[model samples]
Target: MKKRTAAAAMFTVAILATAAYAAHPGADYIKENGYKGPETCEECHPGKAKAFLDTVHWKHASKVTNVDGLDPKKEYGMQNRIYVMCNGNDIVNNLKEIPKNPETGKTKFSGCNTCHPGDHLNDVGSKGAEAEKAIDCLVCHSTAYDFRKRKPMKDDKGRVVMGQDRSKEAALAIGKPTAKNCMVCHEAAGGGVIVKRGFSFTKETDAHAAKGMVCVDCHKAKDHKIPTGTDPNNWANDGVRLSCADVSCHGASPHKDADLNRHTAKVACQTCHIPRTGGAFAKDFTVWAQNPDKFYEPTTLKLEANESSPVYAWYNGTVANTPHFIGPKGSKKDGKSKIYPFKIFQGKAFYNKKTGELLSMDFAPPMANGNTRAGVESAARTLGMKNPEQVAKEAVPGWQTIYFASSHLVTKTRALSCANCHAPNGVLNFKELGYSDKEVVKLTSPELFFNKVAAKMKEDW
Candidate 1:
């Protein structure tokens, strides 16, 4: 009798789980047919597949039309993008030979495609029918996509790399992308949770997420091209600027206070909305070097962790990007400049002293045997360095910095108190922000507040 009762409980639990899954919109459609692959999706979404192929997400390359100091016509993306994070791209011929995770003890493929929506490795230029096959439709559209079902598989070159799940259930489970679909890759970018964007949108951080709004609601895509507003770290820009004052969302004058509304002319919404960031998961600095175990692990230093206030800067929607540095191109005196909040990322990268160029360190090569010299050589060759050996030989580690906009983790109703910026020990350093002593005094004075309010009231009257 006890054995029968146990069996009944197990059956009941299975039924409930199945019922929940069956509630998905596409689940009922499975009764008509089964999923074959991306071909199955193409049967219905023919235009969508073609449209997505043209996007930055599919090509991983873009004609950077909006960034300053870089050739706008020259296409740039992950193919040649380098960052101190991950010690640059970790591409290796044999993906299976890459080192296992110290924490998980599982050998996993950690390439750029690990977060990409496509199944093909580095097939950035794939188009038409070829791109449709290369694209992993279920990865983004299906609620039933299972990571467990995606085991390591062999690529066309017989190299063992990560695989995808296009099972019948995954195809049948196709639905509009939710936060879960987007966060699967975004949350894990730059190696771990909230690592890239110190405080990404979450239920605890963003008012939008708290209200169950997904990323796509704000970052709406047209032909899969999403707007990324002036991130110095990013290599591509589609020129579709995003603003808080959009007609569909917040209007020009959102605040009840006239003073606050006037401030919008010289201050971005994010400066006040994103009061603080990091939230204990942020890493402000990372130093990359071969570990004692011969595996290259980034030594992270959390200089500003656990809900730290942002570094305020003036921005004019332009950036200075080069091989060694990337930063905003706005000054306090710039008439077009507006105050913005930013999370500063600083890191160390290997630089070739001879060529005066930064060397990319392929983490996979060093991870296998801890030979950082070889990793540097591999990266130098990939970057078309004529003398890879000489470049690697003369490489010296140095620090670089990039500032990312703090545009998310927004509080709808919460903002920095006047004291947070106006007090003697305020968050912003007026001198560092290019303010003269006299200007700082006037800016921080209590009389400034009353004067502004009085002026606003007088104008209203």
Candidate 2:
């Protein structure tokens, strides 16, 4: 009888757990009527709408048109014609406008606004009018706006099929923006969570966020441009500037240990801070040599992160330029720069064998194009759909690399130890980083400790 009573209690607990998981009518709420643009929102909350018009998110996701055929900001190897034809030439307007086959008037780019909400069908052009139309405030301010939408599937009955915007329903019932809202783009980036972005940032974890200080606390935007660069106007260098040494947040003398303080100039605050990222699960990266999966539904998710240690590099702001790969700028010798931690995401994109150029794939949204005729024509997919028997087809599989600045997951513990990089078994191959193993070992030897002590002694005077 006691055992039976215990089983009943367990069943009641299971029901409550299911209710929590199915947190509905609150957020990720599907709007049957779809998203209403920023203009309509301005009527109720004029202040937020007027101010949000100037933000970097607005510019990068909405304002800037891919006018320069040569530069797509970040290289994906996919050519403009193939991308434009699939996602449509319209990079201007948000998602209210879905790109149609100018000939057939069928949907083309459906899930383009998964990151930036609004219309994509209408051409915003160089003019700001169309760009202004795409701003959806619930994206940033609403606590419930989880970045989700219906998978672009076609109806077999020849009926006009339409996708969904959960944010529209989410916008109706709203509150102040939380870390959850910011992660709509940050975490769900690069096709999946923990795939890209610095530290796979999440609200529930991270040191500052764990305490209660949210993203906006440090990353305060003035007129929507976040100033992280050496120079304020240079908005490109946004995320590189925050430090514990800064006067506003934490004063210059934050460290109690004078010995550790000397390493400040050479090493970044995050180098010692943010130790491990992702809650319970550590961060990692991988690329497919063959059988690449779809955009969002990547099957190769391993709970363990790729590298136990963050890659050390001299970070200034932007990464060093390359034909394909770009590294954040940091010099071994330059005093202005600091040795920072970086998260490396390794993935695959097709590359031309003869020319040695990295090939590109059209990164369409998750489950966007299935077996539909439009899916075959878009080229947004990789060769995963192709028969395995025809494996070594035309384009030879090549590897790709993405570097993210590892500064977000600011935890008090979990820093890399001396052996993690200096020892022979370390994650970083010294030779790959342009150094001999013995030389780097000697460089990180006891002398670094002694130098810190001496600097502390001098400060005492």
Candidate 3:
């Protein structure tokens, strides 16, 4: 029995050794050859090779040649200096000192290729050819875990095994283009260069980070083609459409006029609502509050109603002159001649009095206090009036005598504001209206409810 067990053990050891050899073919090759460079990959994928060369990434790593000499006032000026930002004790601190090759004392260029080593065509060359297409399929798509080196597990056959198949299977199990892939470069922990100002690099920094969302969620395409640009190719690109307002994740639209499907085609959602400065992207609302100049002020109006006095209404200074109400001619039933009270009931009274005489009382106000210009025009047409002035004259007396003020001025008045139509229930927040904010901190603050949106967005992505 002891002799039989020894023979079985010897057979298992032989099987395990053979399995290890098969799984680690590349490992031995890499150690001996030391990265032949991305040129080998280009042999299979040439289209991606050409596209990557045209990007800013390739330009950063391209060695200065006879045709690429420096010019003080030209494209090769101080702007071309590759100085990495040095944050003391920060993730980027390692980058402060110029990158040096351990084998050869040479400074490495600051470019995508630095992190994406698989894109280099010649590992030993001063400048490597762009191999983005090759890298995408090989490096980015592959798992980073060291699978080949892992110990093997035996099968029911009683044979020793290195589990090479299991390692490859495990790598393939992870989803592609996930936030996990993006965080590999975009996060500070992942050797990211983009530093967020006033905000630390944490899971909270990227709302999607916590929800396991990958970078590809928002930036869908592998290429750098933005949908809004003038490039005709962009029209054909099948990337994800991200809207600033009414995204499924936010649970509400931030745009005063949220049109989900159409808005993304017309504008970039992040241009206004997301804060890009200092590496932060739409973390909070404090940034918006501090940078009023970055965004467009929304049209606003305030209406105050009272039983005894003329209803008061005002709009933003630019829109204050728009007429809100009108009265019928000589219909001074309220004992006020030529002057109409800014009340819906008052207008109703004038309408009733004038319509009592005519077979059809077609008198209506030029516009209501909170109505938009287009809305007012539609209402006038519905009431059979040719213009706002005709309705104004017939519906109220002294309608033009009403004072105009900024919507902000009516803070003390008990009235409904323009938000009723423009931003009801926070559905139409002004930030989503393609307005950018310079104050990133304020725009991304918790008080602004940005996290709530981030959380929702992460889930949706």
Candidate 4:
């Protein structure tokens, strides 16, 4: 009968293309466990791929060496816009080879491969061997990594082809790396965890990830470096980077008040101990309003959770606050400026109403690259617009705030006491915190400044 109706229409188009390849997001965990990338887990994990290629998360994908420099007239006395570095050019060298945007086919914003997914690495000199998407390391040592339910499917030589043996069943969901493999790109940081990481890393839990600790147990690493302790003289240089006071897990005066341990020489034990975080995700900004012709993809967004509201600034962790916003110096008249505590975020942007400016300079990650949708259409294609929501109603609106310095929650019963900033509807506003209205009437009359400091400590004892 006409060859059995063309063999029943090629067996119903091969069972509807295998039910549209099991609808992605780890596509049946990359087809029942298989992702042999990261070079077959570096052939039996070569010392965890040479200590995860000296991390910053596998060199944040590619090209990095712009250690965010500064000098602003021998230290913050004025103009240099007080240290905010997404890379303020110490050295970014030629570092090219991003290519792809033939009119937004998209790919050129190298703020680290949009968050180190895979298939890059072969620049900065060439002994070239890796890059067939070499560091997928089962998207961080798999907990059966569904790699954000990956729906990629490219091929025709465009690479990324997850069919069949799925890189050998994603190498049987690899071996170790939990904290659910580092919150699958850190709880969608800046684009997920309720839009730029705040309290509760989106839901992966913290307080040392619910008391089990991992993020390589306080970011561990030896000779391959990765310690980034942000200097206490390079935390005694065990290749630098390790502290919560060098992981005694809090004991360099874990505070029982020596006047909050004499404000840690201008504050920074995450400023008055994590006084706030992620609250309904402060000014959510709809996860940075992506849509340069609709591109925001944390595997197809839905995120909106948010929370946090602890803003009290003056950080002095040097210049533009390295690795983005160091909450330790708001120089309330700079005696090495202390008075810290900030988590602030308040949003609202899009400017340039015929030369009002401020459309994107502040977006900075070569134009806003937190986790990358081509760094949000390369800061809306470097603000030429092309239709970032048709230039948002002929644009012109401001307010940014940002200031993270949000060190994770530690909780000595939610800290922040001493009348939550010497109350009077507190949280600091002493003439918008420059103080001196006689120090805002002795910090808003705290019971007559503690009854004149308890009658001048009973007339100096």
Say which candidate scores most in TM-score.
1
Better of 1 and 4 by lDDT: 1
Clashes of 1: 1
* Lowest lDDT block of 10, candidate 3: 358-367
Q: How close is candidate 3 to the true structure, as a TM-score?
A: 0.29
TM-scores of the candidates in the order shown: 0.83, 0.59, 0.29, 0.30
lDDT of 2 by residue, 1-461 (tens): 99999999999899876664464333332344444656555554465544554444543422212122234354222112222112221131123323433334344333333444333321222226554554555666665554444323345754323333435656655554567777766665444555444354444447687778767778766545554422111223223356667798766556787645766767677777755533111111112121233322223332333234566667665444333454566566555677776665454433344554443333332133222222222332343433322221344444444455666667665655444544557644556555666777775565655666577679988
Over the full model, what C-alpha lDDT does candidate 1 score relative to the true structure? Answer: 0.68
Model 4 lDDT per residue over 1-461, tens place: 99999999999888866664543334454354454455544444465554555444444322212123433223211011212112111112122233443445555332222344444333211122453334455666556554544433445866443222234545554544666676666665444454444555322334565566666666665533445543211111223545565635675666775766665665567655566665322332213444564333222122232245566666544423332233333467767665555555444434446665434322332222233333333445544568654444455544444455455655555566556667777766767767777878776777744765577679989
Clashing pairs in 1: 280-306
Error of 2 at 26 (Å): 21
The RMSD (Cα, Å) of candidate 3 is 27.1
Candidate 2 global CA lDDT score: 0.46
Mind giving the per-residue lDDT tens digits that candidate 3 earns over 263-325? 333323332222222321111100112112222111212222111222222211111111222
Q: What's the CA error at residue 399 for candidate 2, in Å?
A: 1.8
The Cα error of candidate 3 at residue 92, in Å, is 17
